[model samples]
Target: MDKKIKVGIVSYRNTRPLIYGLQHTALSNDIELIEDIPARLADKLKTGEIDLGLVPVAVIPQLGEYHIIGDYCIGTEGEVASVCLFSEVPLNEITRVYLDYQSRSSVALLQWLMRESWGIFPEIIQAEDESYREEIKGTTAGLVIGDRALEQRLISTYIYDLGAEWRAITGLPFVFAAWVSTKSLPASFVQRFNEANAAGIPRIDEIVAANPFPVYDLRKYYTLNLSYQLDERKRKGLELFLSYLKKDNEQPVEA
Candidate 1:
C-alpha cells in the first residue's frame, strides 16, 4: 500500500473548489487533506506535518526546500473584493495601518505597495480580528483578506484591492496561494494531483453552490476572485513577491 500524501490548506472560501474537487475525484484515496489557517498551514508545512499545502506566497520564503508541484493557484486578475485596505481616511493620508494575521502574502504585498508606490510610512499594527474596522478608527487603515474582506464591503468607505494594486504596479496577475510540496513526489502521484486539480476547475460552479458564504455570489466569486492556473503572469507575480520578501528581510532592523 502507498502512503497517502498529506495536504494542508487554509480554511477559506476560495479553497472550496480545490477541496471539493479533490474529495470527489479518484485522487481522494491517494491523499489526505488537513485544513487550517494560512499561518498554521505554513507551520505544518515546515514541520513536515504535511507533505503538500496550499500556502501563501510570502510563506514560501520561510519553507526551506519546498517546491511548487502544480500550476494551479489562488489568485486574481482584477479588483479582488476579498483582499482590501479599508480606511476612513485616504490611503495617502493615513498614519497607521493594521495588518491581518491570516495572510502573510497580503501583508508583504501591502508593505511593498505602501513603500514603493504610496511612499508613505505609517505605523503598522498587527490585528487578529477580521472585523478590524471596529478595533481601528480615524486616520488608520485595516488590512483584511479572505472572507473578512468580502464582509468589510458593506461597512468600509474605501476598498483598495491589493491584488488589483499588484497588477497595476507590476503588470502581472498575483497568486496568493499555490500548490506546493516539499520535494518531487512520484511522477504518478504528481500526475494524479494535476488531474484532480484540473478536474476541479471546471466544477467551480458546483463547489460554490454548496459554499456557506451567503453574502457573496458564489459563481461570481469563483469566476472573478480566483485564478486556478499558474500562468506566466502569476509566475511573474510570484517571483516579484518572493524578491520583495527577500529584500524586506535583508533590511536592517530598527533599533
Candidate 2:
C-alpha cells in the first residue's frame, strides 16, 4: 500500500477557504490532516513530524530545507483585521509588546515592522498563556491574531494592522503563511495539492455563508480583508519581507 501524505494545517477562520477543497473533496482520502496553530505547525514541519504544512512565513528561514508548494496563501493586501497590534498608547510611545503564542508569522512581522518600518526596537515578551487581556497590562502592547484580533479590536484604543503597515512602507501585499513541504515530494502529488488549494478559493463564499460571526462581518473579512492568491505581486512582497527578516536576524542585541 502506498504511504499517505502527512499534512499540517492551521485551525483558524482565515484558513477556512484554503482548506475547504481539501476537506470536502476526494483528495481528503490521500492526505492525513494534522490541525494546529501556525507556530506549532511550523515546528512539526521542522522536526519532520509532518511531511507538509501550512507554515508561517517566519518559520521558512529556519526550516533549512523546504519547498513552498502552492499558489494560495493566507495573505492580505491591506488592513487585515485578524493580524494586528493592540496598544494603549501611540506607536512611538509603545516600549513593550507582549507577543501572541499562537502565531510565529505575526510576531516576526511585528518585529520586522518595528525594526525596519517604525525604527523603534521595543522590548518584546512572549505571552505565557492564551488570554490576550491577561498578557497585556499598563503600557505594554499586545500582538493578537486570528479570531482574537478581530474581537479584540473592538475594545483596543489603538490597533495597528500589520498588513497595512507593510503596504504603507513597501507598497505590496503581505503573505502570512503558505503550504510548504520539507522534502521533495513527487511532482504529480505537488500538482494535486496545488489543485486542491485552488479548489478552495471559490468556496470562500460558502464558508462565509454557513458561519456568521457575531463580532464582525464575516463576508467582508473573507472578501475584502483576505488575499488568497500567490501571484507575482505577492511573491515580490514575500521576497521583500524576507529581506527585512534577514537584516533583523543579523542585528546584535544591546548589552
Where is the poorest 10-residue window by lDDT in model 2? 129-138
Per residue, candidate 1 scores C-alpha lDDT tens digits across 92-128 of 8799899988877888889899999888899999886
lDDT of each: 0.83, 0.86
Query: What TM-score does structure 2 among the candidates reach?
Result: 0.94
Which lDDT value does model 1 have at 255? Answer: 100
Spell out the clash pairs found in candidate 2.
none
- Candidate 2 lDDT by residue in tens digits, 1-255: 198899898988888887888888777888999999988999999999999998999888887887988788989999899999998788888889999989898898888788778887788888867875665656789999998889888878899999999889889999999889988989888878888888867777788877778998878898899988898999999988888788778889999
By lDDT, the best candidate is 2
lDDT of the structure predicted as candidate 2: 0.86
Lowest summed lDDT over 10 consecutive residues: which window, candidate 1? 128-137
RMSD (CA, Å), candidate 1 to true, equals 1.6
Clashing pairs in 1: none
**What TM-score, computed on C-alpha atoms, does each candidate reach?**
0.94, 0.94
